[model samples]
Target: MLKLFYTPHTSALATRIVLEEVGAKYEITLIDFEKNEQCSPEYLKINPRGRVPSLVTDSGVLTETPALLVYLAQLFPQSRLAPIDDPYLFAEVQSFNSFICSNLHVAHSHRMRGHRWADEPAAIEAMKRKVPQTVKVAFEQVERHLLRGPWVLGEQYTVSDAYLFTMAQWMEADGVDPSSFPKVLDHRNRMSLRPAVRSALRQELGDQ
Candidate 1:
């Protein structure tokens, strides 16, 4: 059995969605940010980075959304969540996920987590103010070139889709109108219709 540590409304939701997509027998542990439970000594032992979406496997532990999503897809290849058989296509999946993590996710984080990059109040505020434009530019690239239609990587609905859907959920909060990017917005809508995605959202957001 796999155990996933996560917080709602975070990128952790992507990991949870993948877990459901793979139909894995897993349990989830919530790390409440409000209570500072993520910084607790007990949680620190599980994930020293003090972040959400830490997966405890029989072999060991895995952190980072891209890694976790790929791990789950590879663990259950029958689910076809990734192109595990084709090395080139698999790398494409990885590349898409990397961009989301390194670019989009980081841009979104600046809205509230500017302290991660700056100490001066002015610098932090500057980053916060720039989030809308930066995020819009990042998604423009995704919508125009990276997104590849019906799903993130073409006809297949891979882990990349789940990752993108997770970040797209933050568009409004980042002050970027999601409707501006038709392809990305449509992809997000399709993702929301997936049973796995629906289950994950229900688990995290409840009846709201």
Candidate 2:
């Protein structure tokens, strides 16, 4: 069985969502950030970075949500969470995946995990202030890339689309208006309607 060390509302949520979509049997180890369990020696042994998401497979441990998403999609190609039929489509999906996980995700980290980069309170505040502008610009670009709406790569719902949805949910909290990007908002709404997303959010958020 696969094991995933995860925390609710973190990028790990993207993995949980993809796993559900792929119908993969995986166990989740909830890392309690509030209690500093992620920093414990046992957890650190698996993921040196102390990140919330660490995918333990029979072959090897996979860290990074975007990579895990692609792995899961490829593992269960029947889910069609990613394109295997055409290299061009697959490349496009991977491209969006990189932007969401590496680019926009880091921008949001400025708001919540500013200490990772800066110690001064003023510097942290500056990062926090940058969130709205950065997020807005990123989503505007995301909006522009919307091929025909309903998903990141148009009609087909892929693992990368799930990733985009996960990150887009952070827009409001970052002080960016989702309404400003009609296409992105519409895509996010479509994602919200999927059973996979609903299940992931329910499990991650609990009764709240």
Candidate 3:
């Protein structure tokens, strides 16, 4: 069995979605990042970077949202989370994964984690203010590359769809205009309807 160390409303939700999509059962341990529990000695032992979405497998611990998604995609090939048969399409999937993580995720991180980059309060505030513009720029690229579909990859659903959906869910909170990209909006709505995605959301949001 896998043990997932996660925090709600983080990129970790993507991992949970992938796991659920594959019907994998795992123990979920919530690391209250809001309260700085990730910094605790125990969690730091699990993940030196003190990040959420650490997967403790029989082998060892795994971190990084994109890495975890890729791992699970291979582990459960029947889920068809990725394109292992087509090299070009697989390359495309990897490209999009990096784009979402490097551009989209990094842009939004400035809003909440400015302290990681700068010490001065002014610098932190500047980063926070830059989030909207940065997110807008990144999302615009996502909007442009989004295939004509309810999914990022068009006809087939991939792990990248869940990844993008996780980032898209933060558009409104980051002050990015979600309406500008109607296709992406439709993609998000479609993702919201998936049972796996719904399961992840329920765990992350704690439904009443």
Candidate 4:
């Protein structure tokens, strides 16, 4: 069985959605940010970076949402969660995930995680104030180019969809109007309707 450590409303939700989509038998351990459990020594042992979405596998542990999504898709190829067979298509998937991880996610982080990049209060406030524009610009690129349609890679429902959807959920909180990006909003709505996505969300949000 696979074990996943995660917190609600975080990038880990992408990994959880992939796990559910793959029908993988797994259990999740929540690391409550409110309680600072993520910074505890025990959790630190599991993930040296003390980040959520750490997957404990038979071989070892896997961190990072993009890697975990790809691993699960490849592990259960029958699910067809990714286009692993095609090098180009698979690279496209990787490219999209990388953008979410390196660009979009980082943009969102600046709103509250300004401390990660700055110590001066003025610098932190500046980053926070710039979040709206930076995040809007980042999503504009997705809206105009990166987002390939119905699913990130066009008709196919790849793991990239989950990753994109995860970040899309942050639009409002990041101060960007989701309506500004119709395609991304539509994709988010479509993904929300997926049974696997719903199940993962319900679990994370403790929805019943």
Candidate 5:
């Protein structure tokens, strides 16, 4: 069986969604990231960076969100989460995945870690301004490319959509305007409508 270390309301939720979508049997071990559980020695042994969503597979321990997603997709090719045959489409998926990790995730992390960024009021205020601006551009590009979708990658659902959908939910929680990105909004809705997604969210909420 596969073991997943994760946290609620985090990128781990996205990994859970992908696992469910692929019908892969896995056990969830919650890590309280906010409580600093991730930085604990035990968890850090599992994942040196002490991040949630580390997958313990037979092959090895897989860390990082996109890398884990791609690994799982390759492990279960029949799930069609990635394009194994089309190099171009695979590149496209990788491109979007990178955009989310580097652009979207990084900006949000900066905002979340604003205090650590500086003690000066001016520096903190500057981060408050710049982080949102960075996120705005990344999301705008996402909004532009999302085309008439239930998914970011078109008709078929992929890990890319799972990541982006979760991020969109974060954006909503952050008071970001989703109305401007109609396609992304619709994508989020479609993802929410998935039974597996519902299951994942319910589990994350400890609904049983």
Candidate 6:
């Protein structure tokens, strides 16, 4: 069985979402950030960076949500989470993947640790102002792509949409307007309505 170490409301949510979509049997090991379990030596050995997401599979240990998603998609091509045997589709998957990673994910990381970015009060102040702008731009780009339909890639609910939906959860706290991006709002709603997403959310939360 595959074992995934993760915390809720983190990028690890993306991995959980994908695993649910693929119908892959796996065990989730919760890592409590509040308890500092992620920083422990055992967890550190799996991921030296102390990240919340680390997948231990029969093949090997996989870290990083995007890498794991792509890996799993390829491993189970019939799931249609990602493209296989087609260079163009692979390029598109990677292209959109980078957009989310660099823009949305990185900006969220900054917001999660803005104070640590600088010792002085002034640097923290600057980060607080800039991070929102960065996130907004990324959100706008996502809105543009999602305008096509209920999915980022148009008609296919792939890993790209999963990533977008997971990160868009921050909109409420970050003050990013999903209303302005109507398509994105709809897309998020559509994703939320999926049985797989609901099941995964419940399982991860242990809400029997």
Give candidate 4's root-mean-square deviation (CA, Å).
Answer: 1.2
For model 2, name the residue pairs that clash: none
Candidate 6 global TM-score: 0.92
Clashing pairs in 3: none
Q: Judged by lDDT, which candidate is best?
A: 1
Per-model TM against the reference: 0.97, 0.95, 0.96, 0.97, 0.91, 0.92
Q: Write the per-residue lDDT of candidate 3 for residues 93-112, one digit (tens) a residue.
A: 88898999888899999999
Off by over 4 Å in 1: none
Q: Which is better, 3 or 5, measured by lDDT?
A: 3
Provide backbone clash counts, one per model: 0, 0, 0, 0, 0, 0
Q: What RMSD, rounded to one decimal, does every model reach?
A: 1.2, 1.4, 1.4, 1.2, 2.0, 1.9
lDDT (Cα, tens digit) per residue for candidate 1, span 1-208: 9999988889999998998998899998888888999999999999999998899999999999999999989999999999999999999999999999999999999998898899999999999999999999999999999999899889998999999999999999999999999999999999999999999999887612
List, residue by residue over 1-208, the lDDT tens digit for candidate 2.
9999988778888889999998889998889898899999999999999997899999999999878998998899998888878999888888888888777898888999999999999999999999999878777778886435667777788888788888888888999998898888888888899898999998987722
| Model 3 stretches astray by more than 4 angstroms | 146-148
Which tens-of-lDDT digit does each residue in 1-208 have in candidate 5?
9999988877888889999999999998888866899889999899997877899999889998998888888999999999968999888888888888888887876666676668988887777777657777888888876443767777877889889988888775554788878888888888899988998998888922
Which whole-number lDDT from 0 to 100 does residue 113 have in model 1?
A: 89
In model 5, where do residues sit more than 4 Å from their true spots? 115-122, 146-148
Error of 2 at 104 (Å): 0.7
Against the true structure, candidate 3 reaches a TM-score of 0.96
Residue pairs with clashing backbones, model 4: none
| Cα lDDT, all candidates | 0.93, 0.86, 0.89, 0.92, 0.83, 0.81
Q: Which rank order by lDDT, best down to worst?
A: 1, 4, 3, 2, 5, 6
